[model samples]
Target: MPELPEVETVRRTLNELVTGKTISSVTVKLPRIIQRPAEPEVFAQALAGQTIESVERRGKFLRIRMNGLVMVSHLRMEGRYGVYQAHEPVELHTHVIFHFTDGTELRYKDVRQFGTMHLFQPGEELVQKPLMKLGIEPLSSEFTLKAMTDKLSRRTTKIKPLLLNQEYIVGLGNIYVDEALHSAGLHPERTADSLKPAEWKRLHEAIHETLERAVEAGGSSIKSYVNGQGEMGMFQHQLLVYGRKNEPCTRCGTPIDKFVVGGRGTHICSRCQRLPRVKKSSGEV
Candidate 1:
């Protein structure tokens, strides 16, 4: 799944490619991808003649602001968007295409078909099903140290899983979560509520730093991830932990370990991030 950095990259690229362009028509080859208005045909019809004014992201969802409506799109695993000339042949995976007035098109292709699009009225977008439930973005000013600490205080779930929850801290997925935890020298299985103030502070900084660095590197291109220009991300080359399983840890020379945490493949350095003592007392209590 595309995480915060990946989605942010996509948003930047799509904004440049599609904004201010008017939609002349829409073709939805896969009806199941449209989840709004209860009809796929309506999804296509509603987009016709509307101009894409701006592109914004809430967590993993992409919001394309049109004249009077907002189109919320969630690009699930392996989903991507591209801009093409009218003569460009659409890929076999391209399930949706938005024809523009100037002999151009914005195409959506998803191998898994898990991507979704929901069109809502101007002000009703955030109230709609997907975007309404999303939580604060980690990079936003509203996500403060106090906000993170308070949210962490309520959960006994593993730190990684709790961080993965979009409602708790939007835009973190497996790759970045692993990198953040590893960077903070924290174990993935550490209980969320057990985090000390210092630990939370470290985690917070690591999250910000990891994401900022990833965005700067254009996000990690683990596989098939690209910007609007069809270019691969450079962050993968700088990854400290993700996809480095069995490789030497950059800090401690220890072999990086990969394991499943909360059903997600997680990576960490055993030496740098020691396993939390299972029976350690909750020092706070």
Candidate 2:
């Protein structure tokens, strides 16, 4: 799954590639991918002749803003978008195609067929299902240390899963969460409330710094992820712990470890991110 940085990269590339282009027609080969209007025809009809104003990203979703409608698209798993000339042969697994007036086409391909598209009137998108429950953007001005502290102070959930919850912090998935936790030198199993003030500060800084650097590097392409231009991300080469299990830690010589936390694969350096000791009952020991 592409995290915040990958999604943001796609948004930026789509904005450059598709904005201001009028949709001459739309073809939805996979009707199930269209979650809105109940019918693919309605979606195609609504988008016809509508000019794409811009492309924005909310968490892992791509918001393709048109004349009067906002098409919210979630590229779940292997879904990707690319622009090609009309004469180009449509590739395998291409589920959606937006034919532009200029003889070019914007194609959506998904190998897993798990991507989704929801159409909405401009303002309603913000108040509706997908976007409504998403939490603050880590890169935005609203994500302050105080804000993070306030949210985590009341939750007892383990830090890894807590950070992965879209309701609390959007755009984080297994990859980035592992990277962030490792960067912070915090154990994945640590309860949120167990964090001290200094630990909270470290976490807050780590999240921001990790995400910012990943975004700059175009996001880690650990899987099949690519930008709208079909470019691979370079951040994976800079990763410290996510896919480097059994390798020596960059911060310490400890071998990186991989285990399951909150049902997701987690990576950390045991020496750098030591779990807190638990007090045992007097008789149990």
lDDT of each candidate versus the true structure: 0.90, 0.93
**Candidate 2 clash pair list:** none
lDDT of 1 by residue, 1-285 (tens): 888898899999999988999999999999999988778888888889999999998988888999988998888988999999989988998999999999999999999999999999997988868877878799999889899888776689989999999888999999999999999999999998888889899999999999999999999888888877888889999999999989999998999999999999999999999876767578855
TM-score for each candidate, following the candidate numbering: 0.96, 0.98
Clashing pairs in 1: none
Candidate 2 lands at a TM-score of 0.98
TM-score of 1: 0.96
Identify the leading candidate in terms of lDDT: 2
Least lDDT summed over 10 consecutive residues: which range in candidate 2? 147-156
